[model samples]
Target: MSIRALVYGDVDLNTVDGSAVWAQSMTRCLAAAGCEVTLLLKTRVGNERLTAPLDGAPGVTLRRPYEESLLDDLGPRGLTPEQAVALITRLDSERRFDLVVLRGRRTAAVAAHTDALAGRLWTCVTDVPQTATGLTSAVVSELTDIAVASRLLLCPTEELRGFLESSVPAACGKSVLFPPVVVPPPEGAVGPGTPRTPLRIVYTGGFAPRWNTLEMTGLPAALGRRGVPAELHVIGDGIHRDPAEWAKRMGRALEDTPDLVRHGGRPHEEALRLAAQCDVGLSWRAPEADTDLELAAKVPEFGALGLPVVLNRTPMHEELLGPDYPLYAGEDLDSVADALVLATDPQTYRSAAQRCADASGRFTLERAVERLRGHLRLALPPAPGGVAPERPLKVVIAGHDLTFFTGLAEHLMALPGLEVRLDEWEALHTHDQYRSRELAAWADVVVCEWCGPNALFYARHKRAGQRLLVRLHRFELHTEWPRKLDIEKVDAIVCTSPYYADLTRERAGWPADRVAVLPNWVDVDQLDRPKLPGAQHTLGMIGIAPSRKRIDRGLDVLAELRRRDPRYTLAVKTKQPWDYWWVWNRPEEREYYERAYRRIQRSELLADGVVFDPYGPDVAVWLRRVGFVLSTSDDESFHLAPAECAASGGIPAVLAWPGADTIYSRRWIHEDTGAMADAIHSIVTEGRFDAVRAAARDEIAAKYSLRRVRGLWTDLIISGGFPEPVRPDGTVPAIR
Candidate 1:
């Protein structure tokens, strides 16, 4: 299928300028590359002349705000950059464009910062801080902001790309080279003749002083001194940077110079024709031209006209013409003169022009088409062969609480061709049977988040050819839910850790091949927030339900720490036993929580130290005040509190439950409450809490990153197959 593209440039195509010409080339080339393009145009006056080439071009369609009467509605600055973004939104809503190419910095910046478009942007930013020192704190920040808005940062020259990626960290790896294109000559245009006397040299483009246009007239005098009289013709009307001064300077330079002829601006075709008539072309620019990271558009245009050009001897020019090309010239009159005199030599002239011809070949329309196709390919990569069908696999994820798997769900939903449906059970044991059965029949795969009644129901009632997967956490493993599951019908059992997988296999009598481990995804970026002052004194515990979470042990650690440092406090962020009707009904569970509360109130240190924060989805925020997260359970499938704490830039003081070391580092685990107190005190006294936090954060990020885990889940859901088994140490293998 052809790629659908939305192209926008904040340029007026009615004029014959570089930006205008670039827009024209871009629109034509995108169509050539097989894209069904909607080129949103911003035209001043009229664009009939400029857009003539694209009038009947297949695969190219034009949309102008002026023609749409949006210009009349929005008033001046016709098709403003922000309006461009709005137009993109409107068109995208009508029919999604697979790719978006943004050329103007203002439009790109607005789109990027607004997040109106996310990773779909293929942004081309020509102007940015160039020098290392020029990238001040503010400039770096600005560049970083824009960097996130684009999937690729398009550069016309490798030198510029290298500079940007090296200086601005945000640009690294995202920068790509898309060289300046040479617009193909008009059909049936004239070609250059053999070398002639009174060597005719032409310079065409904007009369920017930076381009050194005024200095070219002196080349005739310099060439004459060398006994080679040269006729210098200059074409262009536009002026940049102090236009009045440039006009005055250029007028004085051109007046009464018999060898010099200045022609006002004309169409691009006329300029090319004039260039072909000349013996050689001039692209010389000022000493301080912004050429370090940019290439002169006219340089290749001169080459396309089969005319050897003299320009600033920069790296980009050297890359185009070999470093030893005979026509290399500096901006000064003598250097250009010296090169013009050399062009008088037939052997030198033909060789330089031949090099020009060869260099221009790289920028031909066909090559540009291929490069652009490659860029689009990289931007939107296809799924692995045979793994992802053109039609998305219908996946239904059923669970009471989808909080744990939300990231994975979102990832699957965003995937190119993966349809994800959720069967949210009212409770672990209950759901609308009719809806559940209907979803089971429709889904290619049904994933039960917990091995509860949902898994058993799906295993028993799943339609033929539909794969069923069940995730087993700690609580569900102890229940009879696993024994009831139809092991033969179940495709795979997902365990968060290796120890739990072993337990699931042993207790449920499920075969090893049927069980696979995919750990929980931690939203690290969300959790990694700055901590409040005195956060080191606060100990945090997420849950203490039915007393198995060992909130008493957390209070014990706090009590012991406060004996040495009274600043240390225990903050239990959990739902009280009374809040849960099931746990409250258990006499032992009620007694356990009552006893833990009595101990916290009775003990002198823990009385003032222990404070219970309400449980909610705002754990990341609550962790800001928590320096050390405590997990004192007797056993765990995979206690996520400590890993999440580590992710939130806090050290975890965990009691070494059985198999705990497999998932958490030994440095974080202690044999008892006394050892836990000692570790926390030492970190506090030595001011090593920051170092410990960094280390723990790194470890958690490497292990439980949402991006990696989401990918594993995607593989499992898409392929209806298990990923590699978890190692004995709880480490998952990289997806192959």
Candidate 2:
């Protein structure tokens, strides 16, 4: 029997934006999987202009809110809490839904009102608790109450499951790890031929700050310097400025190098087509943004297109690219140039591209949709409101912050049904305690954060009834953390990106089924901005550490810029004297700190104009003043600094490091210090800084908005089997 499901979110199904594309792909996947899927979108004012069909997928229907005030109703202007409850009641009375899947906080609340039909309700939660607002809070509370009172719950990643398990007691027994549905490649897509004319390098995304378009343009210019035939095609709308103006500015910068091509923005199909024409795909992420989950969708798209990728050596990339992939680049231009040279060779890159294509098949939308369908089948039987015998649910949390533990404790305290506690314990001078065995005994579940070094050891000691879950960040592979973690004993591991999850599972000796990928969350309301001009010239960096953060690397770029023009003043937020020692061991700390301190002291001596803000007190003010933000991390999980800088309307100058490339495209970096200096000069002297900042902010607000992430989290969590209800009926849920 086929299941009928209702999916609701704020994505524009007609557009080519990431969220819209995801929604469209999901709709297609669900339809292809033989599920009757109706998508309910919050009607926006200009939505009529975007009335494209939902890709003509079978078993799919698209609907808008009845009153046209759904967005307002979700916020302060529309429905009051009591009115919302009444409206939800009225709506459910009209339609008999066998299953209702909530996408975000607002939609989740609507699902919650159907508690009487709790046997049929499923809530999908995406990000951490930090992203939602009072409205989201209300919806989450309702969903939590329903999960506690209902039959089934789904979590996308173990990270989210841990969060839900701690936030709502009803989630303890029902939760399961279900990653997002992977979209399939279009049919008949073939790999590109050898670099025939110009070595066409394509970057298919918006010209956002995170895209680091200026830095990207500089690479082609750098190639021009080396006398290599290279051209860059940027195929997306201007996230910050008018497409024409952005093209004009970028075009002028590359006028001396005839090989460079700035194709500006194109429609989704057109962009993909353009990308197909290229020999290489350049994708990257901001190392500091902590939002690398966005890249999960793009990586498959690149592979499906059959383009060899010049990726940043992030853990996600390392996981996704496999061993046969091309070389990993650091922050230096020579490193990127070396990678570029290798990638330009058809013999070297073609096989790797094929490998990427092969890998992409594993994550195709059809497979993901089928996986989700099976999970739903297992989840649907018990129904929402049914009650069954209760048993002690064993859970294990591997690694995380103290606040996370406290949060979990608070959530468990609210629910009296299941007992929960931490499973392992270690004391670190940095955070007070590293791990605790006492906490492990108390925990029915074990939760762990895959910080570094200790993940494998903790994974090895799992006992029966205790499921081991390792939450991964970007730094897992770059450091020795993966080496130390025991993968065989881990019941499940969660990642923010599928690329990362797949990689972690591959390396850790864990079953493929044991890994789950979920997106991270951010506070949307706090990301609000006051209208300001984008021409600010001040540059900012918000991280404190040196080694992987590559603080010295950023200073080098700045120093190069200053050598050309003494007026180039850069601002940095450095590590506190005490925190500097925490990143490395005593011996490594001494070596790294001495080098970093000397570099900082030397930069200060060389450029008295450079300013250092150790305490980040003026971050807000500096954010407004800065035209650019720099990220030079040698390694990273997801850097929050660059994202925050872009959100504050600053253009980003990112080091083309490994983990960061997975988040942003490589087109954002210069191949060398000279190129970096030149790009900086162009931005400052050519008045392009305004456009960069404008594009940066728009991209963050629209594409990486906390709201979009929240929706993704909801989908992943619900699809993963968290908050599933127990029923008297003899129905078993599918685990794969």
Candidate 3:
């Protein structure tokens, strides 16, 4: 799959501004690296003369403010740096970008706070504070914020990276050196000929106070004083007005300088050709600023043209040009003049060109493309099925009736490294389609609590790299949801019991390896409270609405217990039968519950012995009044009540309903009501109830406490311990 990128900056690609040139060239470089690129320019559109080269570029798309109506509302102000982020988010939501390339301090600062752009930004902040005095607390904080949100910070030289890392601790080891991507000119260099008396010195790019364009205008006169006539060609029509003096100085010089030829702004290729026609590319700047952090963009552009460039002798420049190189010049006229005089010598000129040619190889289009490609390859996990490292796994717990799964969701949420959101459905078979779709797109792992409509929705609409984990309960195995699921799209099928896991494998025809058993866990510490007085004489059951839950069996056991001891009473905690529309709607379910209630009401012994308690989340508080928790069902994936009962300082009296013997301790499971009653009586009469309670609590803590089973779920979902789909290309991209 082609990597999708969004290149954003306030740069006007219509001009030869340093940032604008960097943004455009990087876009081309990314396109060369097999990335489908969209370049979003915050400035006005109409500089086709300067931007025409990128117009026909393959896999490249350019956007401008006018076309997007960013200028219509703002008029003279145009698009704000903040609004650029709005457009980015709008574009991103339509089709997500794997990576976002951003330049400029204000743009990076703003985009850093946007949640949609976080952790995906490749922020290039070349305009950082140059000196320790300029690197104030506020500056450090701003860059640190950007670094926190960005995947990597882009730098042009080690000096810039060192400056950022040393000044702002957050920037340490978070930056990558990204030299300029130089697209060499098609035409070969034209050198000095005949006597080579008039040395041609060319200066391209923005003219500013620090850039020393005004000083460059004085070069020809300096060369004349040195008995060497020279021509200074100043290309590019734009200038940054940060310090108005330089703009005013260059303005008057452009109009008055006799030896300096002002060639108006030309297309990139034509401008490069113009610079190549000259003998030397002039990039010398004033020494008033600590602009030593970055290598000048034009130096490489000149290098690409096979021309020796005259630049300041900073360490960054020295690194680019060898220390002993002949033409290191100052901003003063004499030094520039001496460099120009040296350029007029054919043998010295050829050696400088050769040096420049060798240095230029390090910044070529091919090398830059490969560097960017490798950086992206190592930094970003592959698309279709990989996750970025260091970021929390965004998990969406989706399904209806999350009663059984909310504890697991809470456990995951308690982890500092996981982001959890609940997508509650209106019912088992219905969900908000838009919300489900958005959640599915946003989540790294989607856990459908029950393999119902929610599972079906996610499975059918699953996107690449998004894992779908559907947990199957026993009821869903009997439903049409399992049969209709696109099981191939699901990464793993979870079951609370191995029996159900195996049953799901058999019923749904799922691969045995794809299913895992992660049982329901009780918070043992939370439920291990002081049992209420006379709790030993009480029997407990939760949720008796469904007739298959075998509430009738619970009653027979309670009657048997009461026969042995009159103090024995049953407490059934759940919504009454008529409270549930699903259960009360069915004629058989209503009749079955009515009969059970009638039997309890008519029997003088059981009428007062059974108490129906209201069901709520206060199970730990209510469970104090229960002693022997009964799990008498025809079939169950896992009845959580017995585990919770054991946690609540009570012994579980579970009937051997199908797989109940395998799930619970054999000592707890009974064959019939008589055995269940006999076990409860023996514990109470022998006065070993407290001992049995402690033993049961310890057993529950070891086996089914939230603490015990949490890692299994966390590893399966968060750590992705389940089997992953092998991409059709037969590769799994490593997340570095």
Q: Which residue window of length 10 is worst by lDDT in model 2?
A: 723-732
The models' CA-based lDDT, in order, is 0.79, 0.55, 0.79
Candidate 3 lDDT over 1-736, as tens digits, reads 6889999877776677677778778888999999999988776765775457777699998877677674346555456787888888888999999899998889889999998888789988688878889988888899989998987888787567656765665664457778877886665644443224467788888778778787778888888888888888988888777678767777899889988888977777778778777878888888864366777778877776778878777766766677878788875768877887887777777788778877888888899898888667545534212333357779999988987775577556645567789999998767788888898889988999888888888898788988989888878888888989987898888887767777889988988877866777777754765676799999999998688889999999888888778899999889887888998999999999889999999987798999887776556666878898999888887898988899989989889887775577787888998888888899999999999998888777767767546656776876557533212121332221
Q: In candidate 1, what are the lDDT values of residues 1-736, reduced to their tens digit?
A: 6789888888776656677777778888888887899888875445365676676789888886776775445655568777888889888889988878888767887787765577778877676756777778877776777777777788776567656665566675467667778877766544454568888988877776777877777788888888987898887666665778777877777676778887766667776777778888888888887345787787778788778887778766776787899988875789888888888788888888889888888788888888888767556545533445568778899999886776677566656676789999999777898999898889988989888888888888878888888888888877888888889989889998877888888998889989987887777755776676799989999988867787878878888899998899888888888999999999998888888888877888778888888766567667878999999988777889998899989998889888787678688889999999999999999989999899999878877877667767767776754666444343557664
TM-score of each: 0.58, 0.44, 0.54
Residues 597-624, model 2: lDDT tens digits: 6775676434475677655333443454
Model number with the top TM-score: 1
**C-alpha lDDT (0 to 100) for residue 62 of candidate 2:** 63
Where is model 1 more than 4 Å wrong at Cα?
Answer: 73-78, 187-194, 241-243, 251-257, 381-391, 394-415, 419-717, 720-736
Q: Which of the two, 1 or 2, has more TM-score?
A: 1
Report, for all candidates in order, the number of backbone clashes: 0, 98, 1
Give every collision pair in model 1. Answer: none
lDDT of 1 at 721: 48
| lDDT (Cα, 0-100) at 253 in candidate 1 | 78
| Superposed Cα RMSD, model 1 | 14.6
